[model samples]
Target: MIALDIENVTKSFGGVRALTGVTLSLNEGERLVLLGPNGAGKTTLFHSISGNILASSGRISLFGDDITQLPPDARARLGLARTFQITNLFAQLTVLENILLAVCGAQKLTFKFVRPLDRYDDIQKRARALLEEWNLVDAADRLVRNLSYGEQRQVEVVMALSGEPRILLLDEPTAGLSPAETLRVMEMVRKLPRDMTIVMIEHDMDVAFEIADRIAVMHQGRVIAEGDEAAIRGNQQVSDIYLGVE
Candidate 1:
């Protein structure tokens, strides 16, 4: 079944066309990786899909519901989650506290200022479980600012997952990392339940090919080619535009 769809999507910023007439669909539980060189408009499409930015024109739907005009938080509440290219975390907050906040937000309890901390014991337990699930228990008490760049990225991912989203859009998930750190993140992604649909913008070919069941290649604000990994690898246009193999 199709879990997400983007139809006739277009976005422009002033005179620059970030995306032009892009369309794509993802099956439930499919792992799709968006690939492109710089200026390919991969991030723009991600923003449109995740509702971080409005599409200049098009329709976006999740599991058969139109959400093109929804805000980020509303889309998030609709079982869509995303992670930015940069780490978005509470730097001054401890890992556990940050996780608790995510859990609270997921449960819509963050606005209940009158509620006592004791009232959120279940959320606290779930937060600890997430920390343990990601092997972050050792650093749970440490401030996010004290964590390494790779660790911060890992935490950012877990935070996104805290909501148990049915569809997750990740932007440059392995963007800045040592080879080892990249591998670690890939392993984590690989172990996730297959019931969750994943769409990620990735520059790291190894990680992309390793995790993506389908690959979509973009160039100059358009998707140039999309297919299975083998098809993408042999497509001359993709190799020419992205790999620069003349």
Candidate 2:
């Protein structure tokens, strides 16, 4: 089953084109890694798919239903969730609080603006389960700002999963971590259920190769090559533009 279908998607900022005629698709439960240099429009493509920014042209569908015109929240409701390249968290809130908010937002549960979230037993149970499953229970009460950078990153991933999304878009989840931290994030990703589809933007070649069932290499503003590790490793253009020849 195809979970996502992006066809000829294009995005432009005035005269500058960020994504040009980009087309891609993902099967249910597949993991896809997007590889590109700094100006390769990888993030722009993410924004277009997640509806952070609308495509200048083209079609996007989720599970055979056209979602090109849906808003981000609507997309989220349709089992789509995404994390940004940068950490987008409530720094002032405790880790548990952040996860609670995510669950609340995802389920669209109604609560008074100032009411305590603990009032919802189901929400609290869901949040705690995520923390325990992610091995983040120890830091659940700590402020997000107080946790280490790597810990914070892990929390972000857990929060994204709180909604139990079918399609998760992760943008540079390991962007600024040390080797150890990177490994930790990798483990968290590996532990996720095999049936959830994931599309990630990663600059780390090793991580990309290790996690991706398939890879799409972008250059300038388009995907120039896409295939399994062996195919991308053998592509001369991919080597010249993104991955250097060994």
Candidate 3:
């Protein structure tokens, strides 16, 4: 089944066209990576889909329902979740507290602040399980500010997953990590449920090739090429333009 469908989506910032006539679709459980050089509109496309930015023209649908008019929180409620390229976490909170807060946020109970924090036992349990699944159990009690960069990324991933969205959008998830850390994040990504649809924008071809079931290359605000790993690797246009081949 098609999990996401974007048709002729275009966005502009004043006189500058950020995304132009872009159309793409993803099937359930499919992992798609968007590849491009800097300023290729990769992030623009992501923001458009996640409702962080509205498209100037075109349609976006999630699971066959048009979501063009929905806001980001509404999109999240409809099983769409995204992580940004930069880490966004509660610096002063413990790792466990951050996850618990995410769980509360997902449940729409974040406004119930007068209650004791310990009242959310189920949230804590689920958060701990998520940490353990991501191999972050040992760091759960540490303050988020005290953790390593890679560990903080893992925490962000857990927060993204806490809502159990059907479609996951990740933006440069492995950025700033060492090779070993990048591989670890990739491994965790691999362990995600097979029924979850994933769309990511990545600059790292190695990381994109490793996790992507298919790759779409964007250039100058358009989808220039798209195919599976081997097909993309062999495409002359992709090689000459985006892949830096002569």
- Say which prediction, candidate 1 or candidate 3, comes out ahead on TM-score: 1
Q: Report per-prediction Cα RMSD to one decimal.
A: 2.1, 2.8, 2.6
Model 1 per-residue lDDT tens digits across residues 137-184: 999999999998888888988999988899988898778789888888
| Tens-digit lDDT track of model 3 for 73-168 | 888888998899878899999999999888878867233444566547767788888888888888989999998888888889889999889999
Q: Could you estimate the TM-score for every candidate?
A: 0.94, 0.94, 0.93
Residue runs of model 3 more than 4 Å from their true location after superposition = 109-119, 243-246
Q: How many backbone overlaps does candidate 3 show?
A: 0
Please say which candidate is ahead in lDDT: 1 or 2: 2
lDDT of 2: 0.90
Model 3 error, position 49 (Å)? 0.9
Candidate 2 wrong stretches, greater than 4 Å: 109-119, 243-246
Q: List the residue pairs that clash in candidate 2.
A: none
What C-alpha lDDT do the candidate models reach, one value each? Answer: 0.88, 0.90, 0.88
